[model samples]
Target: MLRPILFIFVLFFFKYTYGQNEIYELRVYEMEFFKPANILHDYFEKALIPALNREGVNNVGAFEESGETLPKKIYLLISYQNMQAHQDVTDALKNDTQFKLDAQTYWETPSEKTPFKRIESIFIRSVSGFPNLDKPADDSEFFELRIYESHNEDALRRKVKMFNDSEFAIFNDVGLNTVFFGENISGNQMPCLTYLLAFKNKEEHEKAWSKFGPHPEWQRIVKLEEYKNAMNDISRIFLKPLTYSQL
Candidate 1:
């Protein structure tokens, strides 16, 4: 009888621990030019990503601007099982011996040889409606990162409500492959939210947006009084994943 009771407790404990939503950290490395891109590439591909994987983090994505955008930037998207996992993985990586050795060259570079001008990090909590980051299918080659800024806190809440109440479902029906939707809890941007979407290529991206515009559900929601003008500004960047990107 005691054995059966203990087994049941173990089952409940595992379920409770593994069933929680995820958190995400998006890191942007800004470079003046391509001079340091090689070093940045080596660090991410050879050291950082592998270290994170050893800590049980997966689906890490490394990307760069697709076109001739000035002031080249690299984006890294990392997902954690929970907020605590984020902290734990970060702490674990710092002490990883192999990672330290692999990243030595990049770290020991002279001040003048730094790889990036500055790095920006954003911490976000996944929206309740889409609480886990989805890994794109192998064929996905393009990712669109979008930031929606609102006029105020109320406006941001309404915009997020729009997504939770109806927008995400519409996206699925319209063939948009959404990876994650996160509210920026702490970041350079205030009163904003960011999301990532994947596509097969440029053509697929254009086609998806075309379909989304006229979708009946979206048409109806756009006319809703509460959601009107919820977004005040928008910024978009197109990215292509690195060859070693896990996403």
Candidate 2:
């Protein structure tokens, strides 16, 4: 009887702990030009994404920066159940035979013919207020990726606090549909947080921000002394999902 009771307690504890949040990996691949971009796209569509799916990661999102631009880039958002799963999937990829065979074309490309100049990877832990990544609707056409940079760790904490305590609520009130809100656990941009928002079109994107600025809750939170100057700089990028993107 005692053994059964102890087993039940342990099961409940593990479920509560691991079910609390998801981990996200954001990968950015910078291309030198359009020609090489195709190679990267092919590899993602044929090799990497399928391999991830086999490993139980089902919600991989692939996106390209919007508009006609030179020196293109691709963004991939992959979600995991936990930190352990993230590590395990990565380790498995390194030695997976089928993945290697599938990715052979990309692997065999010469240095001169390589598709991307470099890849930037950032790991994020889901915020408590928004613990899971939301999958965008099938008809969703545009995404706005925003990164808020804080001056110091204290300011970063406060900015994140403001989001948890009030801003996320106001965002929902104003029609800023969130995809994910994550604190950067490891990345180039220190003392910052990154989030993704989805919209149906450019017109809708513009209209949402218009509503957000003057919303009462957002106004009140911004005026708070503790939250003042929490963000030093902001970076915004508009993206359109690739045909195969799962987000």
lDDT of each: 0.90, 0.89
Taking all chains together, each candidate's TM-score versus the true structure is 0.92, 0.93
The residue-level lDDT of candidate 1 at 45 comes to 92
Model 2 stretches with alpha carbons more than 4 Å out: 1-20
**On residues 17-120, what C-alpha lDDT tens digit does candidate 2 reach at each position?**
66657889999988876454666778999999999999999979999999876678889999998898889999999999999998999888888888788999
Winning candidate number (TM-score): 2
Error of 2 at 64 (Å): 0.9
